[model samples]
Target: MSYEECVIVDIDGTLAEFDAEAVRQWVLGEEKQWLPFFEHMAQALPGVAVARLVGILSAQQQKIVICSGRPASYQHYTQTWLEQHSIPFDALYLRPDDEDHLADEVVKKRLLQRIREDGYQPWLVIDDRQAVVDFWRAEGLTCLQCAPGDF
Candidate 1:
């Protein structure tokens, strides 16, 4: 589909439930466990309202492009979660494993360029993070904030 037909969607805190305090502690802790964190996130329940919105958008034939800050190394888990939830997506973009240290906004900006290069002309974005919402707006796309994502 053309760029105008594409709609960008975020995973954590948007399509999926996210625990900010748990994540904050994980990030601030000394060990910084990734596997356990990913495992926990993989099992997170889908956001009912947002998932319903996505389903409606899918039914309307809008291309749902899932762009997430989650590491690509755990793509299988993410794919499994989406499938289990029956969430339809035209494409899935995840942050590179090596780029895990970077900020979510930075990682997503690069991914957005790749999405454009791949022929999706994204007209709208659905995200949770305030920073990411601001970034998408800066990039000239209308962003719908699904949750309060100050963290």
Candidate 2:
């Protein structure tokens, strides 16, 4: 017999779009222009749609972990965003204890190592990053790409 595994989600695209206004506020000196571009990268899940998706995933009782390239603080933003949108997920995986840890390739490798060692083997992983799918698959994890409009 086999046990049901968890589901890992990506913040941008897979569920919600990056908050440009939020990111814009952080772009202080040289990064102002890039702020608006964040909007192009993701689509906000419709409020009702997100709630329904959460319902579907919750009914299955699968552990939903959010993995993002953004740092830990972003996780707070994500949580707040969830409340704003009514989306649901269980845990969050991120960088440098909270701020984008995987920016460096070596760090990413180590972070992934930690995730595997932690025993949170996901039944399904959803990500907007194709490279992540490829990498996780190589590590023997099931992954799904968040293609255009993919729920």
- Best candidate (score: TM-score): 1
Per-prediction TM-score to the true structure, in the order listed: 0.92, 0.64
The per-model lDDT (C-alpha) reads 0.89, 0.56
Global lDDT of model 2: 0.56
Question: What is the per-residue lDDT of model 2 for residues 1-151, given as tens digits with 9 covering 90 to 100?
Answer: 3433677676665576544345545432333333343344333553344346656987788777766655554455557666666666776666565333233233345666656566766766665545566676776777666554211
| Best-matching candidate per lDDT | 1
For candidate 1, give the lDDT: 0.89
TM-score of 2: 0.64
Among residues 3 or more apart in sequence or in different chains, the pairs in candidate 1 whose N, CA or C atoms overlap within 3 Å are 3-121
